[model samples]
Target: MGIVLHLKKKEMACVEYSFHVPSLEELVVVLQKGLKGNFADVQVSVVDCPDLTKEPFTFPVKGICGKTRIAEVGGVPYLLPLVNKEKVYDLNKIAKEIKLPGAFILGAGAGPFQTLGFNAEFMPVIQIGSEHKPAMNGSYFAHINPADGGCLLEKYSEKYHDFGCALLANLFASEGQPGKVIEVKAKRRTGKLNFVTCMRQTLEKHYGDKPVGMGGTFVIEKGKAKTHIMPAEFSSCPLNSDEEVNKWLHFYEMRAPLVCLPVFVSKDPGFDLRLEHTHCFSHHGEGGHYHQDTTPDTVEYLGYFLPAEFLYRIDQPKETHLFGRD
Candidate 1:
């Protein structure tokens, strides 16, 4: 005998889901998974407690060349058209034009005409010749290409120069200001790990919903590492075909003790801002744009980062064909 009962239908209701804050171990696991099984023993810890603002002042520009716009950040003038096509730039002159009593600036871009010999001390330059080659400070001028490599030139007189090239960089200038400090360390392991990706994920999880910008130096404590260099200088438009451009991308594997300058953003600011950008210049006379560690049982990374209260995005292209996307 079967018993039948009247049943009432229920309506489904939407529920908001809150993401749980991940612990350090949990965050490490997530980062390991993101590395696709390439694991590196990771450790993350806050070093200093600084009174840092939750929100940072953002200054964004769409294009640099062809426009006569000069913006000042912290009383430092940032002229966009100074590094346009067919334009000559003197690093000493630029420093004089933008120098403040006490300030610091950090950005990346292309510069120094490859064909013309310029007296400048810059390294890890990637330019296209018969083949893609990674050029360093002492030997950069030897490799002559119509276009130069993307580089970070500071406003210091120790390394100054004039160049006929174009650039797009965010110059952060400010007096002494405190920023939140964090330190990350990874021990030698058998597999590779993407340092930038790991740092980005960790920062995002740490900061939660708030966007943050960080700049600091990192060192490849030991073992072999890998980095890439842009084979051709960047412009508002492409100078080579997609196929050729792809061929021009070059990577280098080098020994340890490579010091790097990392400029990272925790969240996209709705502008054409790179979430993570790092460039390395080593005292061993080898450096370039950092990629990942590729050493087996001998790879280590030790880095300290400080979150900034301001981020200036300069010279964004109106329509960029970068990476073959419009």
Candidate 2:
């Protein structure tokens, strides 16, 4: 029998069905079956445990200014620099130097070579920076960039000479806590945007102010998107207008399998939080900052999501105009 939860906030009511899984392996098996188009959407959210005093993982969102040790991985300190025209740190080197254990460290940021201009998705399994790039035959090619760095797309590598990135990262240690599994299935054919929106709305209505961290693989049966690659350099005063940034972005019509990692929080956590930030990587070598999904119909997404216990904001920029935000 499934446990039913009635969550209400601001007069809005949301109902959720909770399931208990014996292990992570079992969760993967369920998600894999969903990917075969058995379900339009499948999500496993972590259950809230009031008795647990410590969070399962920590997320370091926004700008990375190497000076701060926002979090740690395997007892090693993790740092991100304030990258700009005057500064460019070797992300690969940084990952290697950390000497993290064999664990999952997922993030999205600007890089490879900032000057070349490109966005990156990192899925490094510690000690083996597995960077995936686009290969010739509609497939992805894997390489070791040492310390498992982020994968940069060649399609977006344009020479702009001015670029900077406020990277968002999360570190999940091997011994992190696990929560109850909340699986959400779509009743009809849905687009990625709507599917994601449903997932977020459901979480918000049910979980209310509690923050949730969701990560896992999802297959995009029919994909359509707009992606961006960062410029190589940036001025102290950078362009923030949508018209200006649009120049660096490109459109695509894709059909591929992808992985998505996102965090959802209904209420502000007293920090500079994006609230909803998601990045995706695919085996087709087609990925960047996922602006949106324009796929019309028959767009299916199957994923397994888990809630995060804590969030750590790091190196938040004092100036909002740098990215054109007032």
Best by the lDDT measure: 1
Candidate 1: Cα lDDT at 176: 24
In candidate 1, clashing pairs total 1
Give per-residue CA lDDT, model 1, range 1-326, as digits (tens). 11122223531111111122334344445444543334456666655522222211111111111101111111101112112343333322332233322233333333354434332223322111112222112112211123544333232223533322233332322332343335667675544336766566655766666655555556787887776555443333433444654454455686778766566666654445556666666545465656677875777777655555444333334544334210
Residues forming the 10-long window of minimal summed lDDT in candidate 1:
62-71
RMSD of each: 16.9, 14.0
lDDT of each: 0.42, 0.35
The TM-score that candidate 1 achieves is: 0.56
Judge candidate 2 against the unseen true structure and give its global Cα lDDT, from 0 to 1: 0.35
lDDT of 2 by residue, 73-183 (tens): 111011112234322333233333233222233444334344334334333212112343211111111221324433344322133222122243333222222344334
